[model samples]
Target chain A: MSLQASRNISRFWEWGRKIICVGRNYADHAKELKNAIPKEPVLFLKPPTAYVREGSPILVPLYTTNLHHEVELGVVIGKGGTAIPQSAAMEHVAGYALCLDMTARDIQDECKSKGLPWTMAKAFNTSCPISEFIPKERIPDPGKVNLWLKVNDQLRQSGCTSQMIFSVPYLISYISDFITLEEGDLILTGTPKGVSAVQQHDELQAGIEDIVTMRFTVDRQDH
Target chain B: MSLQASRNISRFWEWGRKIICVGRNYADHAKELKNAIPKEPVLFLKPPTAYVREGSPILVPLYTTNLHHEVELGVVIGKGGTAIPQSAAMEHVAGYALCLDMTARDIQDECKSKGLPWTMAKAFNTSCPISEFIPKERIPDPGKVNLWLKVNDQLRQSGCTSQMIFSVPYLISYISDFITLEEGDLILTGTPKGVSAVQQHDELQAGIEDIVTMRFTVDRQDH
Candidate 1:
């Protein structure tokens, strides 16, 4: 039960740790979804078991009919710390990755209505599809990169990191103040305006500026 | 970054993994809190950093004032499995522990009102305090055992496992169908009827039947 490091930059970093995520960081995305613009970063979580590599297919849970793909920039933490200051937050980053915050939108809505926890909605197996790590040096300014996602070759989401209301360093510092950010932990910066449902067999592709690109196929769970 | 096992039965299990918890499993507790009796187990999470052992103080987060104590029975998973059947679920049991799901009740209510995630309220550092492990053999009838918690020697909660709407085996199987249960992972069965706020310096004691008992002191964060 040891948290193992990614053997190389090309390998998927699948260590068993927490995946902390932000919601509605993009104002346009929040408005489109009819959600109030949060003054602070909206936080949520996905278990480590949600990790699925590039070649693997993202399984649509049997209970969800409206599964959506959210393209986000993922910051991988290299060092662990508590109460990290924004000034030194970037030093703790190991790299960046293109991640799809695959969500069960219908289940999420139901949970929201009932004021229940979103575990079953956000933490199913294969719920997080991550691309290979891009060293922090490659993306000198994570705050200004372009990210986009396409479903079946049609562009569904397109935005730049500049559109984010909360910067990576601020999110890192804020999250660390409460939950200790550990090595191998990941921070999902949040999705942009375009988010829509995907069907089984849909080919989903996402990229972050020309540095990293990944593709995943959606499949229905037979169970 | 390896998930280490407890050094001995007397030590706290400090694996870096998810602490999956059930909410509103006790009918009386749910009624008392004015929450709907969930048709299914309400699930939430706490990060590995939340684990604090006896003798150490549970740090009340700076953001919370009405911090409540929820004493629960924790089931520690021994074997890892997915889509496991209920009949075979017991084989996965490594042991049990007495746990307090320390919660920020005020923050939790606000989060619930806004339909936001409970990470800041539930996953903060020292939000969970657990006693040493209790071997499964020591408590043959997990369903019939009694658990109680006292603050400053004043009994605040007293109930039996029979009050749980969802049994341990069913919860393990149900959760595994969605989130994979790994060795060293823990499932916190929901708390019983009585729950109240605690302030700094409050001495908390909780136990499961006569098998295991633990004491903890609450302290306010210096920050």
Candidate 2:
């Protein structure tokens, strides 16, 4: 009813908005997992409680033995809309962020075998750790940017936006047709290859081209 | 940080918080679907975009032909906490609302078999419709209340909360253990048996004993 709130895009997480994720958007990543490259985008979600900034650590859910890190580019919505056209989708972008879509691989494997939802594997607390927002002006061409990830100082994931199966605008338009993207809502574009397990005290570093980089420590949650 | 923004519980939907969901909490329903009774609660999520009220209609996603209606009891969290104990879990409740977890059964079945998330099937626009909020005092025993649903004036689901395999407090405690429950967050505590498909012009009426009732019409989404 009212116009979108005048919240600062830099602090959108504090607004408690939706975190819609796209899975398997990279062909290499799909191959690495021995999965079929999807014809359409694979989608999932992480609740707001999943968000953790630099000050807080990425605590592994107590139930999982394998906690994997997925480096992704997160698009933050500046405008809200339903059935947004691809041509006009970029107009809705406020900016972007470097993010990790942490996954509990063991739990995810069990859930998959049992034909269950991936919530336990994907939506736990500290499942989503992100960098500070990067204004749209910082990246003149989102489609050509580079994204990289490192664990313990060794590069684990390295890819470019050009390798994405679906373009950012295409994803925005497709998702908005049904899910309704709103201001402050986040859409995590799927990860690149080189996803692997992380142990306690491990450090993860990720970046978006030469624009921004973020670091986080991994810790185990006590039962 | 700002004392929960002094948000009115009755208008929690406007706040755009998480809609965490429990699946197969009702044994009879799991039996009907040929799913095993889960040892622990099965969880999923619906984004805030899925919410719709009485005045609006539930539009079946163009991707699904078997849209099913699942009547559920929704718990509105008033306080925020993590790893909440079972005994003190109820103390965090702000109130309750009768809700519908509308699912695109066909798409959900496909997702389940492929080991994918249920976003398209479960989190589309208008997938969640809820009744007016009932203060905590109104429902003295959420575990013993009567919940029922009718389609086109024919009773399709009639089950008491007494049939739920997992009680309200246990669900709250279990969920808050990994996914922190926060102010204004709503949780759909799963549906009972008798889940079935609905079509265009189908009128859905559901209630929580005599405490609250809500209604909505269904129609196919035009592509």
Candidate 3:
């Protein structure tokens, strides 16, 4: 009988990352949103403050009518660099985790119409819910994992990381070319197709097969 | 005799209370950019990740054809709430400081044209540079503060916080209506009239009247 080696537990102090989110890194999701599949990684940010802890409840702002759930794979950086080459990019990665980049779809639409920043829509309280770090060594290849999201009892979105237009190393290298990646920073790889609107009191269960499971509840801000 | 304390000894996180940034907050700036003074805060997110140490250098991205500097007063929140009365808003501030909301104007304009997120343009690496936090006990009145910026001994922007269309308190309360602020979150009050472009190797300086001075130099990426 083999005893599992005692899992080494470590404490991370108020860890926050520069969340670089890739928009439409996956071709099918981009097609569903009617956006062109970009030649380069499409990036955005979910402020460090937008990070919601694994156990914290996801807050749904009252100002928007439709809030959506986007299940993504988050890559956390252990090293820092500027203009990193594609070959040396993976070395900068510290670990991976399951993340949900929540959005206020209605507000995002308003921003689209008025030509405004998506800050209000893409970033708000509890907009990004991330799982605990899984060391990169555990996952041999990040580009072939199975990702899924389910609301309550029904599965909503399911896809493989293999579908991404840009692979993991490519995204890490591409983003570094544009912005520096620092320790504790996170890159939220794009979500799969079947993105849908979520309502208050909805239970969101999102995960990557055999990796991490994030369960969260959406509630209106109790101001 | 009391020895003078170095301002460098002090550290501050973003003040909690949703940060509300006005779009084209200045009338003249609005006119120059062909935008109207927003009746409401041109609300956006500069997540906690966007916050930096007082004297950190602001990095310039390679793709930007023009980089602009916009100097403004940063209001820190001491107290927080939702639906806060404008009459009682000022009581929430913890203190104020000088800040630069650096912009890759050309990239931002391109995003505006494509109806995309401004993250690439506004929320990139080291885009925000702020001064050390001065407690409210020190800054009695936020609106009366003077803000300025210089590029290598040449004054580029000079203005007082008094010119703002939306007062500090109103912005704090108004922003709280949508997003909730937490400790160490900063609200960059809009920049005054003069906002111009900078080039590689240019030295930038920003500060409050006789209170703080932040300086840095821009360099081209060595990719």
Candidate 4:
């Protein structure tokens, strides 16, 4: 086999592609944050540098005191296109991963009130912690998976993908209508309700029910 | 020379690296928009998909009609680092480019009032139109250069880098403190005052003093 063909797709994160994120895609999440239901998908971005694998700890940025953990399902794109139709959105999927959208809540609140970008609150190093990639054949229905997270062995968040206000294909089409979805680009299908503060040295365990689970530790980042 | 060495720095955009942008970095710009002179640098990100080269027309997104043009200087990173000190920031520079931070003013206003992300307002396909890269040797003092933009032969924005609230090295240091500066990544120092809307087929001409000049036409995007 050629070098590329023999390689596993699990290492796709190393490609350094876009990490397009959906915000407030779940009605429960929107209600928890007191944000109104959106008429359309709200989007944001995190650079490739945000990705932290299983071994490394999610470092809470020194600038933020109240760090929050937002667990969500990550869809890895296999193909790339612009203005892609909703019907063909799934063909762009390569696989999936469980991801934590670590946020600095305090900073985000200030930015929100002041009408500022969430870069400091959301785009810091080790902000994204991801699980092992699950192939397409593993889960027949992505919309029905149960994503749960625990902090220090205490259940903190648990939600069904069916609770998403926008479906996977719809988000793909909506996002692609504006931002071009490229190969290896991972779309974070928004977080569920129950996003709360996570402290230093906190142990975080998250999983997509019946298929895969991953564990990570949180530590303070230093200068 | 190896395959890398032989390649010119101008091709850095093709590497698909992060495009970190500074906002309200110019005092005049802050005032023009009625925004406070920020105590520190305001930052944001534009994905690589936003880049549009010369000869390609900048497409106006169907979602907005009031597309404004803000011309700024682009810094291309040569070295990668985190928590980079301002003193050593200059050494990380590889070259520079003249770029337009095309924005949808109407959509941005709505996003701001709602305290939402600027992704839809700022990050769209062809949102960033850039000129060819200039090597580091060509511009020894980037802070002293002049940036001017003319729309359809009328001088709309005329300003100097000296008016920048945060200097180039300062921005590099600040941004790298949060977002790691990778080689091939870009940093768009904020634009000066005099930002306004442009209609379809309007010509945009921008340059850095007598160093480099680029022109592009605007066109409405179709579904």
Which structure among the candidates has the greatest lDDT? 2
C-alpha DockQ of every model: 0.53, 0.63, 0.34, 0.53
Interface RMSD of 1: 3.8
Model 4 misplaced stretches (Cα beyond 4 Å): A1-9, B1-8
DockQ of candidate 1 is 0.53
- Model with the higher TM-score, candidate 1 or 2: 2
The number of the candidate with the highest TM-score is 2
Enumerate residue pairs that collide in model 4. none
Runs off by more than 4 Å, candidate 2 = A1-6, B1-3
The true-versus-predicted C-alpha distance at residue B18 of model 3, in Å, is 11
Better of 2 and 3 by lDDT: 2
Please provide TM-scores, in order, for all candidate models, with all chains considered together: 0.95, 0.97, 0.86, 0.97
Clashing pairs in model 1? A1-B3, A2-B2, A3-B1
Docking class of 3: acceptable
Evaluate candidate 2 and give its CAPRI docking class based on DockQ. Answer: medium
Tell me which of candidates 3 and 4 scores higher on lDDT.
Answer: 4
Q: Write down the lDDT of every candidate, Cα atoms only.
A: 0.88, 0.91, 0.74, 0.90
Best by DockQ: 2
